[model samples]
Target: MGSVTELKAADGFKLAAYRAAPAGASKGGLVVIQEIFGVNHHIRSVADRFAALGYTALAPALFDRAERGIDIGYDEASVQRGIKLRAAIKLEDTLLDVAAAVGALKGAGKIAVVGYCWGGSLAFLSATRLPGLACTVGYYGGMIAAHAQEKPKVPVLLHFGEHDHGIPMTDVEKVRAARPEVQIFTYNAGHGFSCDERASFDKASHEQALARTLDFFGKHLKP
Candidate 1:
């Protein structure tokens, strides 16, 4: 169970967010970053799932800066549209929105960030740029290698699909070599393996990656 709420970024830009709270006491907070598809049903579901696991989870509508109330499907046209919207938005602005969400969750205790697709790269960037995050996890972040020189201020975990055409193994290796301190893993699936709504969804990879992510959060975010 989650609800939509408004949040203001550091720059005074108001955006929408989906927030879910644990039924009882919260162990910590989790910031779930959305894919290029926006903070759609899948992202909300992710927040709800984390809430059920005893964390107050929030998913900010990052695309709200470019276009508000954007919820699109997983089609070729939608993919192209998402890419265009992402290109129009700046990473610095998105990180500001994420910092806003993290500020809103301050009372929940230690905070961690996890993201998918474009949000995945944003999550990694948050670990390196933002403050107050305990750790970070990213899935299939194609842009991570380009920014591998950036050092994370906190522990970070990254996952990639071995068959992901968007992210080559060479890029993954580059990140690994450049940032040996960051934990990196690869699965036998393609891009978007964690997304059940996509054709690339792989149940085995999703389950395994989720388990590792939860364990990482438990170790890093728990009080």
Candidate 2:
């Protein structure tokens, strides 16, 4: 349902992106940000799901800036490597890659962004910095608390795990207090609860978050 394509950012950086088109007419476009693990099978599956929902979806390889073609597993070693790669890449560079992806989805109509893990933070940042977005959804983004003071330029929906060790409930509270206008939801799951490939995956939480996210895109991205 999807194919890999090359995209050029404003900085002339060429990166790979997985693009999935709807079977019939597209309702709009969706930019699916990847976890620190890069645009692996899970991320591509996410794009495919959005495509099945009648939206043209694109998942950019954001880790390409530091190291290309990164596809790691959910093991502890992979987690450490992913974190190191994420730390090496700047947020601005990731946003530039996101802009390139949004550009590739031109003419698909209104666009919305959704992300998981490290990508979740990028999604929230995209709402504040990137243009041509109608809305954004983020799931358990640890860095979001650091940027809580940055108001979103577009409508934003955020999901968090109440027991996420990496993202304390205190930080979540800070974001809620700072951005009262944003819609935020907390589940009884842990970090990476939405990813079935992870040990902390919670079926109930993942389904609920996905339902809310689809409804959000429908309300904001569809005409």
Candidate 3:
């Protein structure tokens, strides 16, 4: 389910991508965004999950500028490394990587973006900034609170945890108030709840969010 590939983003910045082909012809394409932790095993698993659902998936290494081959597990030191990596990279460049991943999946019938944590912010940006995107989904995007003015032309879904310290319920309400048309949901879990590798992982919430995302792609990504 893993294929190493190269993509060119803004200013011809070359980055690495992990791709998993859907078991059959893809009904759509899923552009999976990575967490602040980088495109680690968890992100790869997400791509495989989408592929299992018949959507060709690609996880872009948005932190390629910070470190080329960075894949860290969730230990204290590794978490610090991830934090530094997250702070080192720029959001503009990250979005460029996302755009490049979308371009690389040109053969798929339609394209949707799903992201977690930092990637979640990228998902929101994709829906608002990138053209030709079918839809977008974000899980606990902390940065989105600051970028609340951005709006999606296509459909969008957002999943957040009520207990998430990184993103408060007030900010979620602000987002909802700003974009009433977009679907938003809240769970009792915490930040990074969709990631099984993280301590915040909530199985029920993750499943429900995944189902809603699949349904969104189904409706928007018509072949």
Candidate 4:
């Protein structure tokens, strides 16, 4: 359902991406941002899911700037390594990679972005900074609070876990108060509730959030 492809950033940095296309005509395009773990199986599956929903989806390997081909599992050691790699790359650089992905999907029509965990925060930042986006969706983005003051240039949707230790409700409240226009939802779950590969995965919450996300994209990314 998907294949690995190469993308060139504006800075001439070449990175890898997993691209998935719809079986028939595409309704639009979707850019799926990856978690700190990189564009692993889960991220590729995410792209395939969106592709099945009639969008051309692309998941870029953002960690390529610091270290290429990074795909790790959900372990304490892997978490630490992902954090270090994420820190090594600058926000501007990450956006450049995201922009490259968005450019790659230009032919597929109106484009939207969806991300998880660290990628979630990047999705929000992409809405605020990047051009050619119809909307963006973010799930449990711990760093979003830091950028609450920045207004998004496009429609934004966000999901959060009520008990996520990494992202406090205070942070969600801050974002809500700062950006009242953004559609935000909370679930009775913990961090990584949407990822089945994680121990914190909650099927009920994931389903609800995914429904809302798809609806949002359908509304905004219409031809």
The alpha-carbon RMSD values of the candidates against the true structure, listed in the order shown, are 0.6, 0.7, 1.1, 0.6
Worst 10 residues of 4 by lDDT: 45-54
Q: Runs in model 4 with CA error above 4 Å?
A: none
Minimum summed lDDT over a 10-residue window in model 1 is located at: 87-96
User: How does residue 119 of candidate 1 score in lDDT?
Assistant: 83
Better of 3 and 4 by TM-score: 4
How would you encode candidate 3's per-residue C-alpha lDDT over 1-223 as one tens digit per residue? 7787889986788999999997778898889998877788999998988888888899988888888988888788987888899899777777778889998889888888989888888899889999768899998999887888887888899999999988999999999998898899999899888889888889999888878877877788987
Better of 1 and 2 by TM-score: 1
Estimate every model's Cα lDDT from 0 to 1: 0.95, 0.93, 0.87, 0.96
Which candidate should be chosen as best, given lDDT against the real structure?
A: 4
Per-residue C-alpha lDDT of model 4 across residues 1-223, encoded as one tens digit per residue: 8999999999999999999999999989999999999999899999998888889999999999999999999999999999999999999999999999999998898999999999999999999999999999999999899999999999999999999999999999999999999999999999999999999999999999999998998899989
In model 2, what lDDT does residue 190 have? Answer: 98
Per-residue lDDT for 38-68 in model 2, tens only?
8998999989988998999999999999999
TM-score of each: 0.99, 0.98, 0.96, 0.99
